[model samples]
Structure formats: C-alpha cells, structure tokens
Target: PMYFFLANFSFLEICYASTTLPRMLMNLGTQRRRISLVACATQMCFVLMFGVAECLLLAVMAYDRYVAICNPLNYPLVMNHRVCIQLVTGSWTTGIPFLIEYTYQIFSLSFCGSNQINHFFCDVFPILKLACGDTFVNEMLAYMVAVLFGMVPFLLILGSYSKLISIILKLPSVTSQAKAFSTCSSHLMVVILFFGSAIITYLRPNTRHSEGTGKVLSLFYTILTPMFNPMIYSLRN
Candidate 1:
C-alpha cells in the first residue's frame, strides 16, 4: 500500500516537472522566447497547481511515515485503502482553486512595464513585477495563498517529523536507530530541498539575494528538486 502511494507520488513529480521544466529549458535555448498571454497564464496555473500538489503530497507522505513509525501495530488500520485514496485525491485536487486564484490575480494586473519576465518562466513574483498599477492587492493575495499552501503543509511536515524523531529516539537498539534514521533522513533531505527552496522563493524578503539568486532557487524547487526526488527516495531507501 505504501509502495502504491510512493508510486503515485513519483507520478506526480513527473507531471510537476513536465509542467515547467521542459518549457524553461527550451526558452533558455531558443531565441524566440516569447510566450503568449494565454500560454503564460496557462503555464502559471499548471505550475502553481502542480507545485501545491507536490507540497501536499509530501505532507501526506510524512503522515504515512509517522503512522508507520509511531503506530506500527495499527498502520494497516489507520492507513487503509480508502484513506490512501482520499489522501491522494485531496492532494491532487486541492490546488485547483489556487490555480484559478493565482492565474486570475496575475493576469488581472496591467503589464504596462516590460512584458519580459525576469525569470526563465512565468512565475508569480516575476510576473508581479511587470504590473504597472498598485500591486498591493495582488501581493497580498499571493502571500495569503502562499501561507495556505506552503506554510501549512510545511508545519505539518515538521510536526510529523518531530513526533517521528521522538519515537525513533526511544528505540533501544543501535541497528534499529540507524535503520530508522536512514529512512527518515532521505525524506527529510528532500523535504528540506523542496520546502527550503520554496520558502526562499516565495516567503523570503526580496532583499535577501539578487534576482539571479531568486531564479536559481526557483529552478531548484520547480525543476531540480522534482527531478531528483525519485532518485533520492530510490537511492536512500
């Protein structure tokens, strides 16, 4: 059952990466990097939706790990087939509303400044930069959505890991501890890679780094992390 969930997760990562990575790479290589308004809006919507799905999926995986570690005897009862289906379904669908919200807010603003996005792809913050009028409303909505999708799932991940770590520490055997740490460490690393880059990209203050740094961090989370997640799980598990 857990393997099935993981397989589903890997599929999500593939879709997530496919949403933006290919276009980003192609844009970088080609001279004609112009994306139409509709295409740009569609790109932003899918990218944000997939990115949110990934975050929620990671949180779901953390809960799975927590159940397996802390409630091994009741793992089957707690994480039954129906519950697994629900979790996956919710993770996949939770982003649809946000997709509409983000896409609408972004395109609503007047791109009176240069339409040239600073980043390789049409991301929220970069797109926000092109808006001519007051972006206070847009920025506020973006941050609010970020908190809902980003910070909430992150806090859940942290809570799950905290409880899992406590359970792991109580184990008496060194071999058991080592094995547990090995499994948890891989997930933790990927979580850090995904959430850390995301926080930097979305939540962090703008002055912390140059625009180039922001784009690099965006690439890390949106492209590199998804590409490497399956590898991390395969190699580390």
Candidate 2:
C-alpha cells in the first residue's frame, strides 16, 4: 500500500513537473516570452490542478504512513485497494473546482498593462501584476485558495507526523525508533521542502519587496521539488 501510494506520487511529481517546466524551458530557449492568452490559461490550469492534487496527495500519503506505522495490525484492512482508489480519486478531484475558478479569475482580468511576464511561466503573481484593474478581490481569493490547499495540508502532515513520532517514541527499543525514523525521514524532508517553498511563495505578504524572493521560492517548489522527489524516494529505498 505504501509503495502503491509512492508510485502514484512519483508519477504525479513527474506530471506536475512536466506541466510547466518543459514549456518554461522552451520559452526560455527560444527567447520568445510571448504566450497566447489561451495557452497561458491552459498552462496555469494544469499547473494548478497538478499542484493541488500533489498537496492533497502528500497529506494522504502522510496519513497512510501514520496508519502503517501507528496501527500496523489494522493497516491492511484500513488501507485496502478500494480505500486507496478512493483516496487517490479524491486527491485528483479535489482541485478541479478550484482550478476552474482560479483560471477564470485570472483570465477574466484585464491585462491592459505590459504583456511580458517576468517569470518563466504565467504564475499567479506575475500574471496578476499585468492586470490593469484593481486586483484586491483576486489577490484575496488567491490567498484563500492558498490557505485551503497549502496551510491545511501542511497542518495535516504535521499532525500526522506528530502522532506518528509520539507513537514511535513510546516504543522501548532504540532499533524500533531508528526504523521508524528511517521510514519517515524522506517524507518529512519532502514535506518541509514542499511546504517551505509553497508557504513562501503563496502565503507570504504580497509586496514589491518580496517579489524576487517569491519567484525563487516558486521555482523551488514547482521545479526543484518535483525533480528531486523521485530521487529522494529512490535513495530512501
């Protein structure tokens, strides 16, 4: 069950990474930063979908680990194939409405200003900057979405880890403690890497002073995290 979840996550990371990074690279190489409105909207849609799915999936994965580690006796029945399918389906489906709404909000804005996006892709902040109209509502909506998808999942992960570590610590054997730590270390690293970057990018106060930092953090979460996820999992195994 754990391996199954990991496989799905690995695949998701690849798809998520592929959604933006390839087009970004192409745009950079060609030095053609001009992307059609439809194309840019489409890219943002996929990126948002995959990114939200990943957030939910990571939380689910953490719950799976908690079940496996903290309740080994019931793990098999609790995380059976049907349940696994449901969880995966839920993860994939949870972001659809959000994606549609966010895309609509972004595309509906009047981009009367410069068309050139500063970043490699049509990310929310960069695209938001191009809008000539007051973007307070959109910015608020984006922050709400970020809190829903980003902070909530992070709290879930932290909660699960807290319970898991507490349970592991109660065990008498040092070997058992080490084993538990080994099992969770990679996931913990990933959670930190992902949430750290995401929180920095999305949850931080929107100000001109932080634009450069936001872009760097966005690149880390969108590009670097996905690229390294498979490597992290492989190394752990």
Candidate 3:
C-alpha cells in the first residue's frame, strides 16, 4: 500500500512537471514568452507543492523499505497501520508550511519591469529572476528550501540506502545477496535517475548555462524519471 501510495505521489509529480514544461517549450520555441501574474503564482504553488511532496514521499518510501528489508521480523510490528497513516499525514502536514512562506514572499515580490523567466517551470530560482523588488527574502527562503527539501531528504535517502546495502552484504549466500538487492534495485534506480539529474542540473552553486540545454536536462528527473519508474520497477521486478 505504501509502495502504491508513493507511486501515486510520483504520478502526480509527473503530471505537475508535464503541465508547465509544454507551455514553456512552446514559448521558448516560438517566442510567445508572455505569462500573466496569476498564472505564475498558480504555477509556483503547484510546482512547489508537488516537487516538495515528491521529495518527502521518496524519503518516506526509502525509510519504509529500510524497515521492511533490513528488519523484516519487526516490519509488521513497527510500521503498523497507525504509523503508515501518520507518515502520509505528516508528509501533507509538513508540506503545507511552505505555502505560507511562499504566499508572503512571492506575493510581496514586485514584478514591475522585465517579466521574462528563463526556465521551463516556475521553480524558485527561475521565478525569482522576474521579481521587480528586492528578492532577498525569497532568495533566503529558497536557500532554506534547498537545504531542507533538497539536501536533508537526500541525506536521509542516502543513509537509508547505506543501511540497506549493509544489510544486503551480510547475507550468507550469493543468491540471497542478489535477491536482497533486487527488492530495492527499482527504488535505487529511481533515486539515481531523479537525484543524479537534479544534482547535475540544478544543485550547482554557480548557475551559468547555455540556451535550451539546461531546459532539456531539467526534464530528466521531472518528466523522464517518472516515466522510467514503472517500467524499470514493475517490468523488471
């Protein structure tokens, strides 16, 4: 059920990325690059919510897998019904706090002059580029987001996978080792595809890049990663 739920979460992520990218591509292709304030705000909200949700859910899934694979006898005892509901509820609950900060920070931004954003979606960095007034608060908020959403979850996933791999290596038989890894291979692959692209594309401290190249690469995690998830996980598994 948690697998399906988290997969559902990723499915929503795919849709969210799809919604913004096409219109952005159309604009970048034909130069119809004008977007309204309302649309930008809405885009900001949806992208932030879904993107953060994906990160949160993936971390949750990793931890769930940790409990199941590394400590099977205790799995049912530990991750019971109440705990599962709390995990899901906590995801949504922790996710909404960003909305309050976004509303205050983004709504207050003055877009008086150039309104052109040079990215596919209204991600914090690209969207902030179009703000008219001082975006110090927005940038600080974005930095906080980078630390909390991007770095922290990544650390959690890494730690979980580390424990998982350690447990797998302890298995006595070669076949058992392979089988242990096989259960998580799908998730491990998904994590690599998503985070690898993200780290390469956006996690850079210096953001200089060429035209269309960055946009194309940005879709790897957002669009292509989700598409690959079911195929790699389900078909292979």
Model 3, residue 28: distance off in Å is 7.8
Measured by TM-score, the strongest candidate is 2
The ten-residue window of minimal lDDT in model 1 covers 201-210
User: On residues 52-153, what C-alpha lDDT tens digit does candidate 3 reach at each position?
Assistant: 667777788888889988889998888887788777667656766776567557867777766667777666677666677788777777667756876788
For candidate 1, write residues 112-180 as lDDT tens digits: 769788887888888888889888878788787788999999999999999999989999998998887
Residue ranges of candidate 3 with Cα displaced over 4 Å = 21-32, 200-202, 206-214
User: In model 1, where do residues sit more than 4 Å from their true spots?
Assistant: 207-209
For residues 88-155, what per-residue lDDT tens digits would candidate 2 score against the true structure?
99998998987788899889988776888877677888899999999998889889889998899999
The CA lDDT of each predicted structure is 0.85, 0.88, 0.73
Candidates' RMSD to native: 1.5, 1.0, 2.6
Give lDDT for model 3: 0.73
| TM-score of decoy 3 | 0.86
- Summing lDDT over every window of 10 consecutive residues in candidate 3, give the lowest-scoring window: 202-211
> How displaced is residue 70 in candidate 1, in Å?
0.5
